[model samples]
Target: MAVSQSSVFSESARGDAALSQINITPLIDVMLVLLIIFMVISPVVGLNLDARLPQANREATAPTVPPLQLVAQADGRYRLDGVVHGLDTLRSALVQSAANDPERVLMVSASADADYQAFANALATAEASGIRQIAHGQ
Candidate 1:
């Protein structure tokens, strides 16, 4: 029998030990599973909010009643519809007006020499009285 090196040792046993190619099938499978899970869950996570959109109407009518007018005077007084009112009475009057016509507009006119505190008070009163639309005028 002829004994040779090829017969005695295999290719890996020949001491030519170099690094082999890495097996990446398991890593690729894990990544693909994660991608699929995210794809399935993304839409469900984004659909959390439910909202009703407003409809557009062609025949929206303007308010028939005139707007409520409040003027701030220099002496810390407020005038509503040309009637001077104290701070306490102004709140009650504004509340009554808002209750009477919920859709009515409020126009606040502050004079050049008016007190800033008075102007702010009148604005706050109107808002607290549930007047939804308030405007500033010259």
Candidate 2:
């Protein structure tokens, strides 16, 4: 039996050329798996709170007493009923007002460009000064 060197060399070259071609089937399979995983997990990540809708009631009554207005300025100053006050005297002023009219509602009217901390401070002062009801005004 005689084996030709040319034939052996040709077979080796064919095998090497086959290896040079890229195999994309595995890469496509991995990409499809990642896409499916993201599609399944995306909705669950945003599912946070489950809220109950309130039933409509037509017989609700309105409040009788007028609300006290407290305005928050852009410069961190507060105005309660046309009197401007700073943070140092805010709590005392709220307490005095509450003493006069215990049933009056405390309304905070924050400026359009006021900082969030200013509004929060006004709310805290009202609550800490023994005011029962508090609300935000336009």
Candidate 3:
């Protein structure tokens, strides 16, 4: 008669050797499941970004434009800062000077006997040529 070998393994030194090699397939599968879970949830949950424009409290600290002194004489002649200017000369001067800074304040000082039309013409001319900030006085 012949003796046969048994396939059963007891919890002893023989089994310990078999258990030494860890089965990491389950750990890797769990990590892959978690990665897929995060990837699927990311699209549903988006990031928020907000940006606002300048408010009423905000102030601009830019260089100011120089003032323009325009005197409308009673005799229908114009003078720019005390310099005598003929009708045509005055218009050209106003346009060139104002071109340097359209925001420059224009102070129109009309004499007591000056025609209202004369002053109006100066103002209209300045305004038509894109000159804003016109101030009138004596």
Candidate 4:
């Protein structure tokens, strides 16, 4: 005897639109990877702020326009022309100096062992104060 198969799947044949649905698995994976990357990098950022300074010669010809000297010591003290100034007042004082002489320039320098980041910060702060002519080194 032969058996007959039933036609149970012969209706309208419609189902959920699987093709149009979004797959979030890849999205989640990418997001997780990015999260881990950010976690690893967040702590390392802004930590290495010290700059390595270069050697200066005592017998170099000076430029026609003098540059106001700013120094950062290894101990984190900031000096404006060898006079110590607090970090809080440094920016404002530089601004005032720039305002008095709009064409003012500054020489940014620090010891080799000093925090380079501090020197860079000082330079940025001075530039922000509108010192028109800025230079680095002695």
Winning model by lDDT: 2
lDDT of 2 by residue, 14-53 (tens): 9999999999999999999999999999999989888989
lDDT of 4: 0.78
TM-score of each: 0.55, 0.53, 0.51, 0.50
Looking at model 1, residue 65 earns an lDDT score of 83
Model 2: how far is 86 from its true place, Å?
A: 0.3
lDDT of 4 by residue, 50-88 (tens): 798998886795556666898877887678877887677
Q: Measured by TM-score, how close is model 1 to the native structure? A: 0.55
| Alpha-carbon local distance difference test for all models | 0.87, 0.91, 0.78, 0.78
Candidate 3 residue pairs in backbone clash: none
Q: What is the lDDT of residue 119 in candidate 4?
A: 86
**lDDT head-to-head 2 vs 4, winner:** 2
Ranking by TM-score: 1, 2, 3, 4
RMSD per candidate (Å) reads: 9.3, 9.5, 19.0, 19.4
| Tens-place lDDT digits, model 1, residues 1-63 | 887888667765654554455678999999999999999999999886878899887589664
Please provide, for model 3 over 1-138, each residue's C-alpha lDDT reduced to its tens digit, 9 standing for 90 to 100: 553345343446578888898999999999999999999999878966577776774466667755788887878888788888867788788888778877788888777788888888777776776767888855
- Per TM-score, the best of the predicted structures is 1
Cand. 2 Cα-lDDT = 0.91
lDDT of 1: 0.87
Model 3 reaches what TM-score against the true structure?
0.51
